[model samples]
Target: MFDLRMWFRALQIIPRLSKDEWDRLDLVSRWLIATRAAVFVMTIVSAGIGGILAARDGHFSGLNFLACLIGLVFAHATNNLVNDLTDHLQGVDEGNYFRAQYGPQPLEHGLMSVRDVLRYTAITGAIALAAGVWLVAATGTAALGLMLAGVVFVLFYTWPLKHIGLGEPTVLLVWGPLMVGGTYLCTAGQWSWDAALIGTAYALGPTAVLFGKHTDKLPADRAKGIFTLPVLLGEPLARRCVTVMLVLQLLAVVTLVWRGALGWPLLVVLAALPLLRDTAAVFARPRPETCPPGFPKHIWPTYLVAYAFRYNRRFGLLFLLGLLIDLALR
Candidate 1:
């Protein structure tokens, strides 16, 4: 049966689906889990921020906005599929890899065959490409160029980028300027440096999430010669880097408001400061080898990333709300 509740749960948390449950799940559910749909909200928020900025500037197009949103989300899904496939094929997830410890790795866990996963990737990439083509036809060369950039990131991000020390910075760029600014161009039919700047602020959240995940898997990555940012920086400095990025996120907003790019309404994101404070505290310290007291046992190995995602979700929603109010008043 198609369980809407289960589907929603998967979108919120990476549920550890049993083998029986995986078999019983509907195709949509399987696809959602395989794509790590829980994190899709970040891309949606990035796209929404872009569209809202375009609307405030009197250049929003509903059709183009929808196209950008779908295209980005599908591209993200395709990227996730590609990441899993690359890791599985490389034997990176073969033994006690951190990836399989926290959530299901379809191939590693025997939940899906290689061919089935590739089929999923193909369908998802096709949808994203179709949306990109539509936007390029409707908008212009700018949209085409942005789409090409996104494709490059999608294809190379897992292989050489993540394998090197460029994965974290790639997340920062892709989630920030590339996603938000590109969406603005798709809808507004023009580029805005302001959109790119604002997107950088929100991009910190996802960037921090990736940092945390990489830090969590730093040992595994080092052992396997992955050379992620965390592996390159080492655990202590990497943790400090995440804290610095979070502080920069707030500073970016404050600068925008001061320079008149954003309104005082954007100060409402300060509501997330307390959460950010707690998250910073966590990031300031090394992740515990065992589940800390009161931490959910099921999510033992996923400490920092979970906290980062929670802060990101709250900060993103508040940022969006602030933008909406600012737009309404103007």
Candidate 2:
């Protein structure tokens, strides 16, 4: 296997992981102690969405969930290493010590050698690609295409492709729909509107991530000549766009209802009250409280709202608990 060969190679570097390079591992952030949790949450959300869709059809595909989860973790972790390396190469992440210390960027702070980043990316990416191929072979060719597109998106987003004003959308579209769709297909064994509607909840998660990150890094972005959505769209237009996005999200549920994609059993999924409230909070601030208002920028995705909307895996627990109650009371 690709992984076994790498471990054998590490044997050649037996003394490499010595105390001299202990600081090298500082590249990955340890502040939250929950990087794996984030990955797990995403995997579960993927499987959960698949499960809900399968439930709609009166059948379930557990093997597909497992296969998709495995493939997703490998791909997500590979994307992390790629992003870390690309950010370091582009000068966008070198000085951001907090990002290096707290985010998964091991290369920025020398936590892992540049060699480590490269080696791990190759090994991990190969593993992800292999898993994806295996899933596609057993399931359908569509899964393979999804995985391939994912890699292309991540590569372009972190490197040459991210240089434009469109990085934010590409990131979300990659993180949200691609992952959701691929994972759903692994389980459902086919595509349907139910899967898309289920995936739609998760699709919002990445926007929250991008907006949250943008709010925090507006200064860094402007300094670096990065024209994010807020920067390109301007404050008023940006806020208006976000409002419309929220309204459209609500309308999706209605449209789904009309199309019978959503059964009445889960009709109450309509009550994402916090999402609505947070959308309003974004409109409350015209500009970053820390930055002056007249500048060509605004800060709507405040940390308060960002963290609030973050796709916490624990939310999956609440979702499962709610499902249990619904089943028990029924």
Model 1 pairs in collision? none
Deviation in Å, model 2, residue 311 alpha carbon: 7.3
Worst 10 residues of 2 by lDDT: 28-37
lDDT of 1 at 112: 96
Q: Number of the top candidate by lDDT?
A: 1
Using alpha carbons, what is the TM-score of model 1? Answer: 0.99
Tell me how candidate 2 scores on lDDT: 0.56
In candidate 1, residue 209 scores what lDDT? 91
How do the predictions measure up, each by TM-score? 0.99, 0.73
Worst 10 residues of 1 by lDDT: 12-21
lDDT of 2 by residue, 182-211 (tens): 666777777665565546654555554455
lDDT of 1 at 198: 92
